[model samples]
Target: MPLADAKQSDAPAKRERAHAGAVRVVAPARLHLGFLDLNGDLRRMFGSIGLAVDVPRTELVLKRSQTFKGEGPDHARALATLRKLADAYKLPAGYEVKVTSAIPAHAGLGSGTQMALAAGAALMTLEGIDHIPSRLGEMVNRGARSAIGMAAFEQGGFIVDGGRGELDRAPPILVRADFPPAWRALLVMDASTAGVHGEDETNAFAALPPLPADAAAHICRLVLMQLAPGLMEEDIAAFGDALTEIQKIVGNHFAGAQGGSPWTSPGVGRVVGALRAAGGVGIGQSSWGPTGFAFAPSQEIARRLYDSAIEVARREGLEILIAEGRNRGASVEKIANT
Candidate 1:
């Protein structure tokens, strides 16, 4: 898809393109800061914080169609649910949805959820449904519940989902704050190695030991006293320390269920250790398993960390990806006449 300005004037002599029904929706990728300790049956209900990143994304284009089948069966199911929701209130049907995303599959970026939501919103538009955006979250989650979907559909800063609740509850209230501009997150991932599957992933959560109150209290304090304030003040050092501490604590708690250790990715401990040795701070895993992220105050620091990690990987013959945090929102691609 090519980027274009809707504001551009169309040649008066050219025919104006038209479609029976069409809409486009862009959904951003997300990063989990830490796992929220949700109460039993609610699973991670304590409410974890998540932020959108620009690198990986999901885009959906919807138009009227008589038949549906192909590559994304999950997306198809999501569209069907949206169509049913539209019909419950007397709305149009038959939609063609094309989904595209940059977020890596099985990397814990919520790619499927984002695609589902983008498709859902576009389907609603194609069907001429005029419902509140608040309802979109729950509706989308019915098909994919990665919370990142709910968070991206809503916007700004950090977001948390309160679990199965009324649509009126909407997306959990977002706590807005700018991540320090100097901070760069180097995401080290392994594409060849697969992590836990979705259902097994859910089971992993189910198997987690109830978070001890002491640990939860400690995390709550760090969020309140250090993390939130540090970001607000743009205090990189303080923010890094708090984040690093929180990650260590949470990582330990999660280890019980994942066997051996609850690491974001393999060899993450080495990367975190190397980054720390190189004067980088704020390091941890995102969610579930197999992707590690660490913070550097500047490109200089990041390079140093990357160089060291590279040497280590070479010695062991491993592959890793290094990505930075995007201050802006998700990238959008508008399909032609979409």
Candidate 2:
């Protein structure tokens, strides 16, 4: 990591200092470009696979509140949590939470998970709760099934959630790689279509084949032998190979659930093929997506691939987002003093 810091002013130089009345936080959106076997009692082999992208951010602003009421279950729960934290830490009495997000709903980007984690973080931090990234991730992940989102928000990078278990301590594993500064992740998402509904999602998995013991072992091999080593060395060739291997294994597993290859979305197969044809190194669909992603080596490669993908999708009259992998994550700014 570089020691020197470079600061660029986004606004003109100001002569005044403002008191902090609110805490602001930003959480990055994630792409589970690939999800493996379904979580079930019959199989101890299932795990979530994904990376955090630099698009569709979730931002939060927390300020002191006075006699505010929360209407929804999630909102009420959040308020209750914040109140408890405040009482425990001897902090302020009232607070307000304002959330702004660009991440689409149910596109498999982990948007909801990100928001939940960010809100939790803001609440905790404002109440003087001392926390490490991993601890904070664990705390927030309790509110949602997606632990990867909490991990991504805590430490920006490629990550995977180990998945919640009966033990209640599913930690995240951050991929060991220095994402190239020029690399960009473009998520081609279709918001018009809905993914597997929660009810259907559970039932779908229930009906799927139980994962064989060998299958989980094979996934572990892809992660350790290929993905882990390749990522650590920043070897695109190796990384691409590993991703391809995982895609095949995981894609096959999801097949039984969707009554097909489990590519989930009807339009993703063509895009994945198109991306590969356009010199894309690795490509896959996010969990139950109407969203597909293509990984390029560089910006030039990304542009070329994106163009090719757009052309191919045009034939089907389908639209997708062209996103880039971000080295650094989202940014949060304080817009007002109060």
Candidate 3:
């Protein structure tokens, strides 16, 4: 469903009015549009901008219980997250958690962070505990790096986080604005290839050279001058150009870690090239991705790009999805237990 239709169909106020036993929360997937500065002179690191997408989200249902139990995909991770949250908050010992729908893990789509927050939010709501995302994130051992996922979960849209410096808090949101309604993003992923994660991800960062000063300067300028302004004015072409430029700089910065090409998957470079050739714009990868995205000015254009790229993606065994930008954050509802 489109975001507006989804909102109307699952209105939280209406659902809450009929509350009985369970709390359900839906959190969007995020596209990490490269970090602002991986090598800042100050303690600040990984300032980021990202867009939240409606489909392929993390959905959870939770209810208070005597002993913690988890069901559905990634059940073990969900249970562990809940236990950590309970331990950190000194909350009650039990909650029954179910992951009804889960974002694909380690796809560079911010799945882990969103799942943690969804689990935290549902548990807190069921227990009648008041909590904000930052505290919830800290309890769940997230937001240690970038705040874009946490902030996007709380209030979706195109988000920019100022980065964590010396503070232990969530990175402050430097800006938040609704992505243009007419613009659509095509998310393409190679399911056969898993993105870098766990110890490997940590080591990749440790191994990466500091981002060149000139490149960092260029990124900062692009975001501040072109990207931010283009979004504000709903200028799709300008925004697309700025995004492409940023991706080129950041992609090259990590080329060594991801083999000679900036992309993690073998054919992703060709796919991106084909999409651009087909008139898709704003091409880029999300985080440590095998998943990549590009933008279109309208639904028709998005579909055309998707149709054109479907063959290329199929040849490479990629999964392609055309999704609209999620202007609002997550939706939490209280559902009656049957």
Backbone atom clashes (below 3 Å) for every candidate? 7, 12, 1
RMSD of each: 7.5, 8.4, 6.8
Tell me the spans in candidate 2 whose CA falls farther than 4 Å from its real position.
Answer: 1-19, 33-44, 67-94, 132-146, 161-166, 172-176, 314-319, 326-338
Question: If the candidates were sorted by their TM-score against the true structure, best first, what order would they fall in?
Answer: 3, 2, 1
Error of 1 at 321 (Å): 4.9
Worst 10 residues of 2 by lDDT: 1-10
Score candidate 3 by lDDT.
0.82
CA lDDT, every model vs. true structure: 0.59, 0.60, 0.82
Candidate 1: the clashing residue pairs are: 37-46, 38-44, 38-45, 38-46, 264-290, 264-291, 265-290
* Highest lDDT scorer: 3
TM-score of each: 0.76, 0.77, 0.91
Task: Give per-residue CA lDDT, model 3, range 185-257, as digits (tens).
Answer: 9998887777788888889888888887778888888999999899889888889999999999888888888
Report the C-alpha lDDT of model 1 over 115-173, residue by residue, as the tens digit. Answer: 65566566545443443334655544432333544655556354545433434344354
| Stretch of 10 with least lDDT, candidate 1 | 1-10
Which of 2 and 3 is ahead in TM-score? 3
